[model samples]
Target: MSLSRNILLWMSENRWMKERIPKFGFVKKAVKKFMPGETEAAALDAAYQFSLAGIPSVFTKLGENITQISEAYAVRDHYLRLIDKVANRKLDIEISLKLTQLGFDLSEEETFKNFTAIVSKAKEKLGNTVFIDMESSAYTQRTIDFYKRVKKEHDNAGICLQAYLLRTDQDILDLVEFNPAIRIVKGAYKEPGDIVFKRKILVDDNFFLCARDLMKNRSNKNVRAVFATHDEKLIKRIREETERNGIQKSKYEFQMLYGIKTSLQKQIAKEGYRFRVLIAYGESWYPWYMRRLAERPANIWFVLKNLF
Candidate 1:
């Protein structure tokens, strides 16, 4: 890892740093280049701006692992409000939800109800897509099951898959039987080697292989693939492999995290590929922000330079 990235990860682990840095007005200002703000409005506005610029987005409210049913219910309400606001404007946007935010740790039943409520409301409001994000490996089976139940009722729903996981290929094959849109990410969390492949090359290879399977399968034509990564080589390989395999550009899209690789986002879009920005918003950005820093490493220096 780069020196700057190392510093950021170190900072992420430093509880004092995560807690105190936001207190400094300048620190918040510096981080705004990436975080946008600590509110739903801030996230919506940023996503709207991207939409205007021809870059579609998936708005993810920044929080995770709710330990209380009340907290999950409240998070569901926040999404309901967001849906209402966007529907009034007739905006074209989708929502990405994390199951952990639905009190998965507290009660599986409660989590299912909370997630289903959000999807039902979203579908009612805008008739747009609702994507359930995959959390850590522990919740993988539950998430898949929850998605299965929800998708049975709402065809517009989808879920994410982590390519780094050992079971991802089989998971994709099995889930494709449901015909849901799948976002393939290299994963963000630091998981155990038993559950996830450790090397970047292995992870990238898994990502492409899974992507290829999803693209080539005939029954999975409805299986819109989201290639969520910033690696240029992987992007090129995707482009070449997709063309070589006769998978039309419209069948899949490239996804990137917001505040990183804007140029690549534009470049891919300009080159005739669909691009979607994963725009995150909320007060609970420390962990997510740390993961982003770990991914780019250079962002650590960027944030530090801004502080100075």
Candidate 2:
């Protein structure tokens, strides 16, 4: 990675930086450019707007790594209420979550129990789905294991895979047997060279490889692939590959973050492809915001423009 990108990612994990950065008006304003606001109501309002635009959404509250079971339960309960709201309003949206936020740090069993509760509630009440967002490499295996256990009972549950990781191709192969639903991302966390691809080209190549495999497996009714990226070139490439391979547009969807690439998202949706926006909200957004900047350093110019 570039030096500036490394600095932004390092800052993303710095407790001191996270604690203080949001205090600045400029920083908070820049964050708003990415997220609608820091509340469940705001998130739903954003989702409502997306629905109006004929776009679906995925909601994820901004926080992770809870040290207490009560905290984890609180997170689960919050999502439960969100699910209720989605069902009550008949909204076209889904929920995504981090295992750590559900007490993975406390105990894997406890996390699974908490995760299962939310997924079960979503399935029963909303007839909707929930996705487990993959975190740093440290939790990759554990997250997949948790997904496998819950997915055996609830097919509405899905998990994310990081294309930047060296093990992802094999992971995709292993997961195909279950005919799982997966969201493929280019990964955000700064990982060691041995376990992750250091160059963007390598990461992009792996992303397409994994995506191609997922497309080939689309004949399995249970297989769903979500390409969660903002790279138009990669999206075009995937589109061409899928078209050439006789894959239907409905077989997989393209996902992008809310407030980023709205035009491209609209274009994709207009072209009759499945498109979903990830709308994140909550007070704990500093780290998430920083990672977003790291993902595209050119966004720093956006932040500067917001500041000025």
lDDT (0 to 1) per candidate? 0.81, 0.90
Give me candidate 1's TM-score against the actual structure: 0.91
Instruction: Measure candidate 2: CA RMSD.
Output: 1.1
Clashing pairs in 1: none
Q: Taking the tens digit of each residue's C-alpha lDDT, what string does model 1 give over 1-308?
A: 34555566567657788777767666566567676678878877888888787887788888887667899999989888888988886667789988888888888888778777878888788887889888878888988988888889888888899998989999988988787888889887666668887777999999989988888773435676788888888888988998997778887899987787788888887877888888888887776777777877766677778768
Residue 140 lDDT in model 1?
89
Tell me model 2's lDDT, rounded to 2 decimals: 0.90
Clashes of each: 0, 0
User: Model 1, residue 264: what's the lDDT?
Assistant: 82
Clashes of 1: 0
lDDT of 2 by residue, 46-122 (tens): 88988998998999999987777899989989998888889889998889999999999888888888888898988
